[model samples]
Each structure stands twice: as C-alpha cells, then as structure tokens.
Target: MKLFKSIIYICLITISLCSVAMIYGETRQSQWIDKFIDSFELTNSNFKFYNIKANMMIEKDIDMNELQNICLLIAQNLTNNKDEVCLKTEKSQVYVNYNDKNTGISIVGIKKNAKESYIIVDILNNKVYKNIENIYTKLENELSEYSNDVDINVCIAGEYTKKLKKAKISDILQKILYNMYAEKISDIEEENFLSVNAYSKLLKENNLKYLDREINLNIGIRYSEDDDKTMIYIATPIIKIDY
Candidate 1:
C-alpha cells in the first residue's frame, strides 16, 4: 500500500494533498496531538521530538495574486514580520518562508488548476510550543474571512536512536494503538519499516477509507541505516506529512 509514501505529485503539483484528507474540529483538534505525545511518552520516554506540523487547506479557488497576498499575510502573522516576507514560486506553488531559528513556519499557496486552488499554512517547530493551539485558532479565524470552509490537519512526530527487534517495535505500536482504543484495520511490516492503519473512536476525528476499510490513525516505525536510529510517528486521522 506504499504506507510510507502515499502522497504523490502530478504535473508538478500536488493534486491530492494529505491536508484535505484529514478532518478535525477546531475545539477538539488538540486531542490528537495530546494523544500522540502521550503515546510517545508511554512507548518510550526518551523519544526526542522531531516536529509538530499543522496544515490548513482553503477549499476554494484563488488567483495567483490573491494567493500570494494571503500567503504573505499568513507569514507576517505567523512570524510577526511585516518588513519583508520571502516568497518563492515553483511550478504551481507559491511559498512563504519564515526566519525563526527555533520555530519555523511556512505558508504555501498551490494552484492545482485554473478552476481549483488552495492555500496551505504549515507551522513546523522542533520543540512543542505552548501557544500552538491558539495560533491555529487565530489563523483559522483569519482564513475564514477568505473562505467559509477550511480543513485542518495536524501531526506530532518524534524519533529516537535505538536499535530494537521487530517484535519490540510491534509491542510499542500495539501499546500506542491500544492506548488510543484504536481498532486495527491493516498493518504492513517490511525488513526495515513497519506501519499500521487503525481507527480510534476516542480521537473524535473524521476517518478515511483505505482498501474498503475505515482508518483514522496511522503509526509507523522505521529503522534508518545511515544513523542507525529508529523513528516512530503517530498521527490521528491519518498522518498528512511524509515520514
């Protein structure tokens, strides 16, 4: 099922961005992040944080000029930099870059086609920020002025350098899934990678179908040969970002 890399680009544009696939309410969105952090702690307390990403998709068409303006606004608001917000255009995407050292925020506006376009605001940080929820809520409210409907997807991820057997990784995955009260839908284990797709009622997030089965939680364990470290990622309503 290509669990590790399910998202693919077409025509130099991401036609099916994972951001639009996952759904969660603004009020309860933090539930998934909390659960993920809890799961990571439970499985291995030494798991160092990788990043926390939040994606917002505006479900309406926008012109390039307007998209650029929105991207700039988002960037300024995120980094509180009104001076000069760097924006770059590549193929069908316009990107806004932030210049913070500890926390990094990026906003991109993608033009899928003439009749369809969307803006994706992604907030990435190496360490967990206390005001992440507030930032998301504020951004959602600001974006609402442009489009009435906005879809939000969040993924909290971490990693650790420890070589463990497949059985041990499976046990960790099982503990995480069980803690979330998730029902396993499918799982794939390769020589160096293991992934599980499941659905958890406690998450309160929307689910997407995979191979005719409903799944809303995705857990992956991978062993890196170069660094010789194991990486584990947990996301509710399916992980939108590539591991």
Candidate 2:
C-alpha cells in the first residue's frame, strides 16, 4: 500500500506539470504570429530584429488594476528588474512597457467585453536575442493563472504569409517597385515569376522618382518545384493612414 501511494503521488505531480505546459501552449495564440518577424542571422551567427506585432486574446472576468499588476510582474521577469509602467485609461487597454536598452516589449491589454480581452505584444527592438514565440510562451505561462477556468484561444502557426506587407523582404522590394512606378510605366509588364534579388538588379537607382515610396508592397509568392509552374501576382491595395 505504501509503494502504491508513492507511485500515485508521482503520477499526480507529473500530470500537473504536463497540464501547465499544455495550458500555455494551447491558450495563447499570438506568439505563433511572430513568424512575421524574421529571426534569421545576417552573418553566420549574428541576428537582428525588425518591427513585429502579435496578438493574443484572453477570455476571463479580469480587473484592470489586477491585470496591470500582473503585467508588472511579467515585465520584471522579462527585464530582470522592477522597471515597469502601466498606462491606464478608461477605453484603452492597460498598457505596460518594460524599458530596456533597445525598444523594449510593449504589451497592451484591451477589454473586448466583460468576458474577453485582447493583448498585443509589439517588439520594436533593433535586434532581438531570443525567438519571440518562445518569449511570449514564457509570458503566457506566467499569466496563465489569470485565465484559470476560462476559454483561452491560442493561434497556431505553421508558416508565414507570402504577401510581403510588413515582411522582412518588404523594404527592399518596395524600393524596386518605386523605381518602376517613377518611370510611370502605364503598360505594366507582367512576369510569371522572378527572383526578388534578380528583379531589384533590373532597375537602377536613378530610375526611382521617390514618389509612392511609402506605398505598401503585397508580395504573395510561393516557389514551385515544377519549373513550368508560374507565380501568381495579385493587385495590391494601398492603405492610407490619417495619423
């Protein structure tokens, strides 16, 4: 009876740990959205980060003040210090920032309704050392208590979007497109497929008029194993911001 009781306790402890991990992985969705920020190294081992934003939603009856305090706890864990601030307002989310050397992690949690609230984590660092998905997963585990006995939805990601808007390759491609638009090519030429680097080489720096440089580039292309297959080009919409 003693041996059986010990085995049962061990099993219970193991099950508890597994349940916690499963909660963080299954309840948090936004971290998986982090693939948009390319973590590839420029050289053999050096890595840098660009602007990236990811969204996660929490379904619970939460208090603003309590959540803000929880965010402070998370910020402390992330930064290894007590430097944290909560920007609270009636309508806006309980925003918090963990001040760091580079642009730090900015978390904004907004209440969608009494039962649902959304949180967005925007990484503005010039270079990020760790993978963002991992970082947010850690954060989710820490904040899992807030989601106790509630409906939590986590989005899983298998791949990044092909449309280059806000992608790592977007800036360079936009430069090339600006040059073509500068020449005022009314007779838009269509190539079934072309390499991004090769297409940029076709246009010279002088060809760019600087007009429409701020326009968004929507590049959704997939490489096909079949040589005869062609990439499809879709019309891109230009979004204007009032601010």
Candidate 3:
C-alpha cells in the first residue's frame, strides 16, 4: 500500500510539472504575439495608406524569442519614409497605409529557417509600380541586356511636373549660352565709351535709317577657367529696331 501511495505521488508530481510547462509555453506565445502587435501600432501611424497585409512564418520548432527578433528585423528592413508609408504587425500579419494618391501601402511577407530566410513584398497600388515598369521596358529596349548592378525595380513616385519644368528651363539656358559663345564677335563697343565713327558705323550696318521699331543691344564679357582652358562668358540682349 505504501508503494501504491508512492506511485500516486509520483504521477501527481509529473502532472503538475507538465501543467506548468504547458502554461509557460502559452504565456510565451501570448507575449510574443503581444509584442508584435504593439510594435506594429507604433510604426504604422506615421504614414498614409490605403491597405496593408503581411504574413510572417517561422518553423514550428523555432524559439518564440527568435521569432520575435526576426519579425522586428523584417519590420525595420522594409519600413521607410521615402515610401511615405507605415506598417503594422499582428502576430504573422502586417498592415500598411499611405496618405493619398501619391502614396500607397505595401505588404511584405517573411519566411525563415535555420539556414536562410526570404522576404517578399507585394507592392499593391504602390506609386512606383508603373514607373518602374515603364523604366524596365525602356531599359530592356535600349540595352537588350540585364544588369544586377542597376536596380530597375526602384522608381521615383511623385508629381514631378515642376521638376521637369525646371530641368527643361536649365537645358534651354545651356543651349542659349552655347549658341551665344559660338556666335560672339569680339571688339564690342562699351556703352560708356562713345566712339563716334564706330557708333555711326554700327547704326548704319544695322540699317537703323529705316528701322520702324526700337532696337537695343547690350553686351558684356567675363573670363573663367574650365577644364584647364580659358573660357570667355558673354551676355547679350538684342531688341527690335525702332525709327
């Protein structure tokens, strides 16, 4: 009877140990989930977005602590202000948002093993998608070759009309300056220096006798060094001839 009591005591002790182990496992899982949710909220509120979805998967045998760390790393790696987006993670799910038409959410998934991990992002309604796609098509047509060094997947997604206008203006100014240098004639008379003969000659050469509209020509010159070569910078303004 004492042996029987001893066996019962051992069984009860084993059961109590098993129950404690189960509770500890549950608590760990709950804590891991809670941490992911909290971190997601903290990170997601900064950006505007339409929608977001994330799926994170880890091997069943992976430690909860390790899983949490991996999730955090994924979040850190994918979130950025240039995208104008925010992300939220709840357990294995992620959510994202962008403020308006200029921005949109992206969903990223992570899968990991002891040897390696993979990250996949689904940029749904992402502003860069069409731009990147167009760039890729153009690149393919131009190069007929693929380069790993070039990131064709990246794009600038924004309203760039103003930027384009500035660029065009800069190009036109450059062309105008180039033309002026090519056409410049030396020995221009200064406005302050009155050369009676040269001034009369200039007016006569320009056919000012029958001019019906006002004509004004202002010219100036400066010097600079470019690529170890002396460069002459010239400015000229020409107006219509007047009687």
- Number of the top lDDT candidate: 1
Per-residue lDDT of 142 in model 2? 57
Question: How far in Å is the alpha carbon of 166 misplaced in model 2?
Answer: 21
Candidate 3: count the clashes: 11
Off by over 4 Å in 1: 1-27, 45-63, 81-84, 89-93, 111-115, 129-132
Candidate 3: TM-score?
0.22
lDDT per model vs. reference: 0.69, 0.43, 0.32
Order of quality (TM-score): 1, 2, 3
Our model 1 lands, by Cα RMSD against the true structure, at: 14.0
Better of 2 and 3 by TM-score: 2
Clash number for each model: 0, 4, 11
Off by over 4 Å in 2: 1-39, 42-46, 50-52, 84-86, 128-136, 147-243
lDDT tens digits by residue: candidate 3, 1-243: 999999999999999999999897656534433432232233222211111222223334444344444434433343345345565655543444434555443433332445333233333333332233332234323222211221112111111112123354334324433432222222333322211111111122122211343221222211222222111111112211110
Model 1 residue 163 distance off true place after TM-score fit, in angstroms = 1.0
Cα lDDT tens digits for candidate 2, 1-243: 999999999999999999998886554443223322221221112233333344456677777776666656656665655645545555646777765676566767787787787666554554553455566556556555555422211111112223323353445334435542322222223333322212222222112222434222222333244443323221112101110
Q: Against the hidden true structure, what lDDT does model 1 obtain? A: 0.69
Q: Across residues 77-194, which tens digit of lDDT does each residue of candidate 1 receive?
A: 7666667578898877899888566666777788887766777776666655345556665776667777765666545566677778868876887898878888888988888887
State the weakest 10-residue window (summed lDDT) of model 3: 193-202
